[model samples]
Target chain A: MKRIFKIYTPFINAGMQETATYRVNWVFYILGSVLGCFVSYFIWHAVFLSGSGETMNGFSLPQMIVYIFLIFLTSTMIGSDAAWAVGEEVRDGSIAMRLIKPVSYNATFLFQELGNKLLTEMFLVVPLIAGLEIVRTVIVGRVEFSVVNLLIYLCSCVLAYLINFFFNICFGFLAFVIKYLWGANMMKNCIVGFLSGAIIPLSFLPETLGRIFMLLPFASLNYTPVMIYMGVYQGTELLYYIGLQVFWALFFFGLSKLLWVVSVRRLSVQGG
Target chain B: MKHIRRLFRIHRIFVVQELKRMMEYKGDFIVGVIGFLMVQCSNLLFLWIIFNNIPNLLGWSLNEVVFIYGFSLIPKGIDHLFFDNLWAIGHFTVRKGDFDKYLTRPVNTLVHVLFEKLQIDALGELIMGIALVCVSLPQLQIEWSVFKVLLGIAAVFFATFIFTGIKIITASVAFWKKRSGNIIYMVYMFNDFAKYPVTIYNEVIKNLITYIIPFAFTAYFPALYLLTGENPLYNVGMTVLMSLALMSLGVFVWHRGIRAYESAGS
Candidate 1:
């Protein structure tokens, strides 16, 4: 047990170091996220206007605005392009060093990815969210905040992050089979973009599609948490959604572990 | 004249090689194309949902928006298929030190870099875009004139030029900043806004899009010319002229940006 801790400590320390190094780039990310949110804001504002005076699918103009702002924040917070890591390392012959590490590469990758992601969200996404509120006040008036709702939203966001991390790691493991994993990852992005209700609200979706999507892991990433925050799903249903996120996270993490086991074995034997 | 002819020939050869390479992984290629088409289909699907709920959005009917979506793809798809390498320019040239090799080459660096890889996978998006225009034709209420048809095609090309130019400019920013690839993220954040009709936006925004960014010409202005019988600025000719001017301006900016290039990793 002490031996394991000794190995893991250095890996965790390295992740902390990388976070510190990349911390300066967080400003660009904040600006980019803010710009992205502004685009979504314009799109939703136009959409709401066309829906006549009536609020389509129970989303008031304010609710729609808030939902889109959160969607931008959540995707920026959780989304990772880690799928390309394995392919690049393998092709470039850097996987050898990873294999020789005292700690498990998968564990290092997971912990490091989480550390980097947390820093990105804190420094970048938080500022953008704050900026959005400031811009909103100037453009459309004041925003109402609820402490209870914020706590629930944060919980859902954590669950969503784990789900995103698991699925993206699964995509990375595909490098064992495919030479270039970009196409596979791009396909994943498209699915997440559409089904997650990031681009369009799930409430605006047809009843059947909305219900089906809400059950999926993709929805947990951006849609469900944002929806819950905007009060789209209430009470018991919100709890159910959060529970499903937990189930999906555990399920995907397990699958990823299995895939990692097979992939590493293949890598070792095939001399990847 | 002879050198120009030779350059064109080399470009054709490069494109053919790329096509052959794409053909090697026929199954993966097909899957990729299908997946891209599905994503494009979802864009249409979103429009369908909106039209079903509200019937029209800021004077754009389901068919008109469909037409705009379809034609907009022409420029975007062409850029993707022909100039996909340009999208990676910032990373490849600056961060990866790949630009060092490009500068050493005798021929024009821009031409070679722009055509390095062709995403034939985007052919799916291109076909869908054309099919969309065809599908909307019968459903479309407005009469199609020969002049309008010419203008439409011109506008699509112009939009492609603008899109490619934007990518080039942003990608070139890698010269000054590490991981300038983030600029693509920023561009995507803004570019997707062009998908909707600009009429829905307030005057300030509409003017910003029209004059500053020229995103309005990409789909909105040309789309308005198609949908409404009367053009905002008289005839389609004027709109086409403006689009050409924007495309030229984009090319000019790209050229200026290229000249400002300082290779990474001194």
Candidate 2:
């Protein structure tokens, strides 16, 4: 166990070094975020214009803009289609070398991915976010964010990453059984987009669907946290959301471990 | 005449081969069709929600909006069906060095790349589009004048040219840099914005869409004619001419870009 930890710590440290560098594929990251944020600004701006109401569902224009901004920002920051990456690696025989290492392949990936994500968020997402905030203030003409709410939002964003990672790993590990995991990843993307309220806000959903959405683990990654930040929920609701996130993180993480073990066994049987 | 026939034969063969390739996974083809329909249904639901809130958007009625969506979908569907490969052409050609094979071909490399794949599932979107048009025509309460019907056909064809033109231009960007995927995404973003009435957007963005990007011609101008039961502006002739001209310009730009291509791998 100690040997495994030692091997992975250095592997993750190397990954962290690569992650800390702001050179490779960073342009695509910025371009995607900029395009997403810019296009969304135009879309919601038009939607909001169709009414004379002061707000849509208790969110003022600025608040709504913030919601959209954070939704895109956090989705880009927190979202990891790990299954897609892992499935590709396994299918291409890269997993062979990974499995031979002293540490568990999944453990190494978990730490490396977290490190890469942290690097991306700090170097790219954070600066872009700061610029977006400035732009939003200029365009919407006001800015209001509570420090406590911001902190909570940030923590939930991190938890969202864990949930996403676990789901990805579970689906990714299926590559051991299925030769092609593109379809599975596609389905995962579709489900997560809808369930997590990343497509459209849960607040925008019908009351019954919104209630159902709240019950789903996917909501903890996005909708619940954003709403809480927007002051849509108070103490008990906030606590419930955070607690639900904890439950989901643990549940999915455990499931990923089980899936990993089964997948490894299947791979060994196949001489893979 | 003989040359034209030979070209047509090659096009047909290309399409047939693409169809055969797609047939390898018949289950996927079916699921893909269903998935596309679900996506279209979601877009239609957004329209329904909008109409439920208000009877019409801007001055256009529900049927007019539906007509816009319908016509837009036709070009979009055909774009995906025939030129679906355009989205990936940049990446495949430049990054992966797939352009070497195209350069070796006797035919126009651009045409070869553009028509390499036909996403058969987009046929579902096209059928839905035609259905929406038929449904919308009756609800719009318009006379079936000969000129109006002809204009509608022209509009749909014009839309195809414009959309294919944009895809070609965006794909041609791969000649310069490998990161042209975002360029394609930017085009799609504008295409999404163009689905609704132009009047819904603010003045500056509206102008940009119309004059600079020419996305307005894809659905907005055509839908306006259908909605008003007359040409919305005296510039119908000008708009049609402009659409064709822009398409030609796109082709010209693609020709220019292709000449500068440095095939990455081979």
Candidate with best DockQ: 1
RMSD of 2: 3.4
lDDT of 2 by residue, A1-272 (tens): 78766666766677678865544445554564565555556545655666567776565667767777777777777777578778888767777887776666667777787766666777765675577678767976777546677678888878878887887788788777765465445555666667787666676778898889888888987887787667777789888888899898898999998887777766643255
Would you list the clashing residue pairs of candidate 1? Answer: none
Give the lowest summed-lDDT range of ten residues in model 2 chain A. Answer: A20-29
Please provide, for model 1 over B1-266, each residue's C-alpha lDDT reduced to its tens digit, 9 standing for 90 to 100: 99989888888989899879877887778777887787888777777776777757765677877887787777778888888886576545566766777778887776788867888778888888889988988887877789777777776776776777667667666655645666665664455556667766678867776666666666766777777756645334544565566556646665666677665655
Chain A TM-score, prediction 1:
0.86
Q: Candidate 2 lDDT (Cα, whole model)? A: 0.73
The stretch of ten residues in a row with the least summed lDDT in candidate 1 chain A is A22-31
- Candidate 1 residue lDDT tens string, A1-272: 88776667666677667878755445555665676566656655766777776477887776677777788778877776556776677657788888876676667776677667665667665665576567656656666655577678888888887888778778887777876566666677888899899768887887998889888888888988887776667889878888899999998889888887888777743354
Cα deviation in Å at residue A232, candidate 1?
A: 4.9
Give the CAPRI class of candidate 1. acceptable
Please report the TM-score between candidate 2 and the true structure.
Answer: 0.87
Error of 2 at A151 (Å): 1.8
CA lDDT for candidate 1: 0.73
